[model samples]
Target: MTTGAEPDHGFAWPDVLCAPVRSLPEHSRLWVALSGGLDSVLLLHLAAFCHRSRVDVHAIHVNHQLQPNANETEAFCRTQCAALGIPLVVRRVSVNIGQAGGNLGGVEEAAREARYAVFEEILGPGDLLLLAHHADDQVETVLFRLIRGSGVAGLAGMPRARPLAAGQLVRPLLELERAELEHWAREAGIEWVEDPSNADQGYDRNYLRHTIIPGLKARWPGLARRVRHSAGACADSEFLNERLAERQWTECSKGSRALSVPALQALTVVEQKNLVRWWARKRGFRPPVVSDWSQVMHDLLEAAEDREPELREEGFRLRRFQGWIHLVPEQPEVPVSPVTLLPGEPLHWAYWTLTLESVANPESPSRPIRVSTRQGGERVRFRPEGSSKSLKNWFQEQAVPPWERACLPLVFAGSGDAGELIAIGDLWCSEQYSGGAPAAGWRLVVRRECD
Candidate 1:
């Protein structure tokens, strides 16, 4: 049933919720992100009346702390949820305006990031996240991306349904218009707050909505419907492109971070960019900007064999080393100073957790040796009596990239930078000092960090 007057008895909230519930799982938690606005108010009310046998319904309100009416907005959400007999989850999030937390793009973008971060956290495996984005919002998004020079990926606009984190996010009301929701709101006698900032044309989306979209719609009636159609076409194209890219991505992928440069170079430039973008997506990072793709193609792969070019953005560095282009987080400079590592203890350093252990060796070096980054020129043998090799040679032999070698944790037997090397970055434990055997298990494990 449509949420419009075209229905025989006019628009109804229960009708709205029941239709969308068909797309949702029969047994899962249903969370509506309610902002106490007209769109969300309508959605929340409708969700409260949804069939409880199919899914449990809930509401979430994120307080960005940006507006002066933040407390009132949250309080309104709580009151409304209470009246509807639905539990509300209110999260108060800090919107940083200070130096470190300030907008890398714009304040709107920063607030959006903070809001989505909270949304992703509240969702668990198979949970359904229902958003109140409507047709007008979809038009605004498509226009914003178009004016900002987006490709098919960006032009695809907000999907009606997509998987985010471990849960599924569905925008059930995307087919409905804000005016229709408002009309229903008035008939239902539901109160909703109007965000004052929505009127401020200073924001890009607001500018497009108030100025550009209106002018365009005046010139071309049903512009929103046309734009929505275009977005659907773009989404279809992206789906097909992703299917092809996934195959190429699997073939060119070397490990978690590295891609086979030769394999990438063999593909057409478009496919290469698609594969790289897909790789970035797999790593939960944004793909490279369209503006940077040409330079990346020329410098990273097409350049001379000896040339090592890199591009860094979004905390990840896409660089070419040896025979591959690797996508790894931009690492801090390897610590020049030595850090003490006590046996059977873990030390956190540079996006990694380094743990060291030692056996009860009577003839071996004492416990609590110092650890530092690889400084080159260091020598170590697998066994105390085995032949020694430079740390550089050993790293090369182990296929560790030069950039990675410096960051691998190096454990020493003594204090200061001059300490004798005992354990090398969770890879090797020196023979004589080897936490030998299962009985004398001295080992170090370097864990890749997620947080």
Candidate 2:
């Protein structure tokens, strides 16, 4: 709660405490993430006093099970929420602070993902996930992201409001300094539990909060205020760029997953990057190291269209073929072992849900079979008179971009000692396997969500 030089000229805090949230929907529910820290504690306590007719108020505490006093902290939050008369949902989550992105920088981010997963899970339509992030928090976030080399959107820092799973996540206290919240809390005699990890300077955020921000403020007073304003400007610029990129994407997309390379080359480099960033963010891809994604865009634009050059990160892959930049999830190296599908067991593959519906193909094999990806030169015939065509050639004829060809699940059926391709995801099946008869082949519904 660094206040700089300003004295707490706080009025009866609730009147101003809820001003930032006045714009919330009239028929929405507001759930506060009460972390038992001073900032979150004060935020939950203050938000309880708001008029609940417009938006109902509730509290949630995610027990990360990380600290020595985690149980005690949960107890403290329960007492506080009970006193405040708000129904509290205590969610216990296991945090695996494993390597995020391509390496080991996801310690803090993993915790955030765990916390927000609970937040999003509980939210219904038109709900608000209110956080307790104050102005000082925003300042630290901006500085931290800056030091780590954030692009324009990262430099913009956390938004006051954004889409959270099925609802909206809003931080109403971004305009109020932490000092004001703490001052009002103390004046009103609010009790909060202190987190032990705040003292650990090993974490980048704690380092910035304890060792950097205070001195930065002392050297350049009102740095927090100026930084917040700069972030706002960046946010505005980002919004405009998104709108422009949407228009560019509408014209330039080859399909849901690829972009037209010729259309991208026609744009300025800045526009191209903006379009790519806009697309990446929409598809839930993390920000790649600057030059890596940049290089992908470069190769997409300048490389020969016939050459299938590709770039891949942990979760995603990018490729250029036939004047389109194709992006898809990176398929892990899977051994060509066929999964045994029983009648009762539900089959869940990577990013797909599978179900076997009774279709009319009398020639359908009853035995369990292999589910695999494209092995080159494999072919399938759609009709009795038609000759088998390569899977690659079929993909091109079907207007399926090259990037998606490798990951499409192919189902193989076996007879005695020989196996033949029977199904290609939910898209098609061989004429021998196609369903329409009274009681023949089972429809293999490989349910997947695509953009």
Query: Largest TM-score belongs to which candidate?
Result: 1
Question: Which pairs clash in model 2?
Answer: 360-440, 360-441, 361-440, 361-441, 362-440
Q: With candidate 2 superimposed using the best TM-score fit, by how many Å does residue 343's alpha carbon deviate from the native?
A: 8.3
Tell how far residue 213 is off in model 2, in angstroms: 3.3
Clashes (N, CA, C under 3 Å) per candidate: 4, 5
The window of 10 residues in a row where model 2 has the poorest summed lDDT is 1-10
lDDT of 1 at 102: 57
Model 2 scores what on Cα lDDT?
Answer: 0.75
Relative to the true structure, candidate 2 has a C-alpha RMSD (angstroms) of: 5.1
Give candidate 1 regions above 4 Å deviation: 1-14, 26-28, 53-55, 98-105, 215-222, 254-256, 290-292, 333-347, 355-366, 412-423, 426-437, 448-451
Which lDDT tens digits does candidate 1 get at residues 1-451? 1122343445455566457755566436888899988888888877776544423788889998888888998998898899988888999988676733454337778778788898899898878888999988999999888888987989999998888777888898897777777776777777888887888887888888888888987898887789889999999998888999888877887444578878887898888888888778877788888676767787888777777788877878888877788888778665678877666667876657776655553343344567788666888866656787888877778888777776887777665555677776656666544434533355555675732
TM for candidate 2 is: 0.80
Residues 188-291 of candidate 2 have per-residue lDDT tens digits of 66787878888888778888999988899899888878998899898888889999999999889844457887788888877887887787777888645556
Deviation from native of the Cα of residue 228 in model 1, angstroms: 2.9
Best candidate per lDDT, number?
1
Model 2, stretches more than 4 Å misplaced?
1-13, 21-23, 26-28, 53-56, 97-107, 200-202, 215-222, 254-256, 292-296, 304-306, 332-379, 385-407, 411-423, 426-448
lDDT of each: 0.76, 0.75
